[model samples]
Target chain A: MNALIIEKTEDSPGVKFDPATAQLSLSGESRPENAGKFYNPLLEWITQFESILFWRKEQKMDQKPLVFAFRLDYFNSTSAKYIMDIILTLNKLADKGYPIRVEWYYDERDEDMLDAGKEFAEMVQIKFDFLPN
Target chain B: MRHFNNPVIKIGAHETGKPYFSHTKHQHLHFSQNIMQDNNSLNAYEVHKFMSKMDILVAFTGHFDHQMITILLKNIRGKLKTTSPEMAIEQKVYCILVECVENVSKYSSGNEDSSRNGMFMLCKSDTKYTVITGNPMLNKDIPSLKAKLENVSKMSREELKQLYRQQIMSERETENNAGLGIIDIALKSGNQFHYNFKPLTETTSFYHFQTEIEINS
Candidate 1:
């Protein structure tokens, strides 16, 4: 599968997902005017990636588990909802026997962000790591 | 003038080249009415008028929603761009507005019928810029609200940051809303949040919050 990498901006964040490396990362501010537009594509990519993994298993293609790391410094209300959606999707994938790890990183001084990560962790069955930067 | 069971105060027009009045409810009401009327779209012009009329603006009128907040923020940014043009001041005002409006959108309890059910206002003067927001909150939530505000008020800058970080690490998250917006407001404003709760009924209270950011320039 081809890799998808998008850089962060003043108004948006950066996204990096390399199927070959199995390393996915999202970082920066995410308060876009139209959050749905920004997130729909990412959601689609994740779904396709999951499908590819599933197909690979059926065909006996050697595959390695993917590691998803979410590092958001600041995200608005709209983006928060989508992020939750992404986490839930990942949890489902993990439940289906896909090796996945979710890491929530926030600044050491940003207690609110830390609490946010904790809150999302409780909702899904996926193992979530809360790291202080 | 129209009168309602609730007391309404009105102040006269602004005095050119004169010091703006503070702590006067009438002035705020009058200024708000004029701004609302003049800016048919409630665009940047109205925000500019609002900033010019008051030294500290605290509006908690029930006219904010998601769409309205977008427009309000745009207008406020426009006003800041045209007037001060300082990045820091612009950020301060923007953060205060975000906190105030997000609270209203999250907690406003009035049903669909009441067009102006929440409280929203902006105040500004030479020394400070203030935003006051009011929304209907459940009576049961009052204690927690009070506690949070009290805790926030007591924290030093470093302590607040630590607390913010701690909250970030907690594993419990709300689906669509997080109370972090208020914390962001406090941090950006560098002021103690001023708030009051007036009972609207046995089940609900009008939660009022006022936050201010000083303008050193």
Candidate 2:
């Protein structure tokens, strides 16, 4: 599967997904006027990546674990809901015995972001790390 | 300075604080006294008509429903369209409205019916336009809110940018109700935020906030 990479803009975040390394990173503010247009494709890419990994496992091929890192400074309420959706997807994949790690990077002063990470951590079964930047 | 005669000062029996005039009373007296002296000058009715024509209404209801916020934003934006054409000013107004509306939803610790709702008013002078939002807040929340305001007030434009960057870089996974958006509003307005908390009831207080953005000629 081809790698999915999107550069961040003033209004949206940058997303980088490497299928070979199974590393995905999203960084920046995400408060687009039309959030669905921006996030739907990213969610689709994740699903596709999971499918490829599942097929590889069925064929007895060795595959690396996936690591997803989130670094967001500010996100609106609408974007928050979309983020929950993404985390849940990852949790589902992890539940199926796939090795997945989620890292939530936040600033020390932004307690809100930290709390948000903790809230999401409680909901998902995957190993979640909260890193202070 | 404009001078007025026969100003009306009304205070409820329980109301205190040197008997200051309410905004509504001030407007009425300003028109009534000025109309008798200058017949052709703007009267209270004319001002009301103009304000109504301008489609500006400051609604203060003690209810923090999400639906009310949506309705308020739509109405305020509609009024701004008729009042000014500057995109920057319009954006400031939008930012202020969003911040105030969200603050009410996030805070306002009172009973359901008595929940401290806010008032939003639009006033324009010859060269500038203003949007003011006022709401009730708990007395205890004032200190932190004031400190945040003071901290932001001291920062310059570049400093505020740096502060914003640092804030983003150091954000934690969770946050308390720390009035972060108020900083954004101050940055956008290019002005110090005006705020005050006055004791209302024993368990509640009225918090007033005002900010103005210049409409460049």
Candidate 3:
């Protein structure tokens, strides 16, 4: 499986999915006018990566911890559901006994962003490391 | 109806006790027109005094477009950096502004005559920061808007958080609309919304929304 890198736009976040590093990360602001159009490909990529993770497991090369990270400063109101969808997708992998956790980073000054991470934690079983930067 | 010109639009009666207003006389005085036109009711003196009373830091009212969002964002960033400056509060204002303007821009009706588009005003006082945005919207959208506002306004903080999570899991999302604007606004602004609706026609109305975020000491 190859890595996927989506450059960040003014109103959309950048997505980085690396097969070799076994980590996927999203960073920057997200406020797409058409959120479904922006998130659909990312969703497809995640589904495809799940199979690749399974394939990597078959190859006996799955020693690294698979991780996901989100470092967002601002995201639109409409994008929350899509963020939740990302978590539910990651939760499926966590359910399969994979060592996986999400890294949610927020500025030390922004409590609302940090609070959002806590709320997300309540909704899913996946381990989320809420880091204050 | 909001417009007195169209007397059939049953507005000023107040007999039904509906929480609605009629902007019949001031329809021409909308933000867009007030910015451009001079013949109507608004004047620079009154606008200045009004903003001064609110302690406004930044304000804009115009057609909701991509270029306008960019310019407004830049201007807002500059203002936040200059006045009542705090990184946390600035971030909060920016986030809320994005949501509020997008709520107007993304949901604004296709009607050609409504002069309010993504009209946003940000004001600061000793205790809190206030954000107000107005949009011209379709009458068909009012029921859901009112329901959402009423539902969230009544919920406690914990209850709103729970409902937010529940909504994410159960709702089917689309491209243009995700139906989370009011919920996020409520959650971030302490679950309170100051909202008003003024009918223009039987089918069109102007939706005005105001939010306050307390400046943490």
Q: Which candidate number maximizes lDDT?
A: 3
lDDT of each: 0.67, 0.65, 0.73
Q: Clashing residue pairs, candidate 3? A: B1-B9, B1-B10, B2-B199
**Candidate 2 structure quality by residue, lDDT tens digits, B106-143:** 55765566564655666555455555565666777778
Q: lDDT for model 3, on a 0 to 1 scale?
A: 0.73
- Residues A22-104, model 3: lDDT tens digits: 88899998877678888877777877877877877789874677788999987876677789888888888789866688899
Tell me the tens digit of each residue's lDDT in model 3 across B10-93.
112233332222243454423332322245444666556545654667777678887668667867877787775578778777
Worst 10 residues of 1 chain B by lDDT: B2-11
Residue B53 of candidate 1: its Cα lDDT?
A: 46
- Which regions in candidate 3 have their CA more than 4 angstroms from the true location? B1-46, B113-116, B176-179
Q: For residue B68, give model 2's deviation from the true position in Å.
A: 1.7
Candidates in order, TM-scores: namely 0.56, 0.53, 0.82
Clashes (backbone N, CA, C under 3 Å), per candidate, total 39, 18, 3
> Compared with the real two-chain complex, what DockQ does model 2 have?
0.06
Q: Assess the local accuracy of residue A7 in candidate 3 as a C-alpha lDDT between 0 and 100.
A: 96
TM-score of chain A of 1: 0.92
Residue B80 CA displacement from its true place in model 2, Å: 2.3
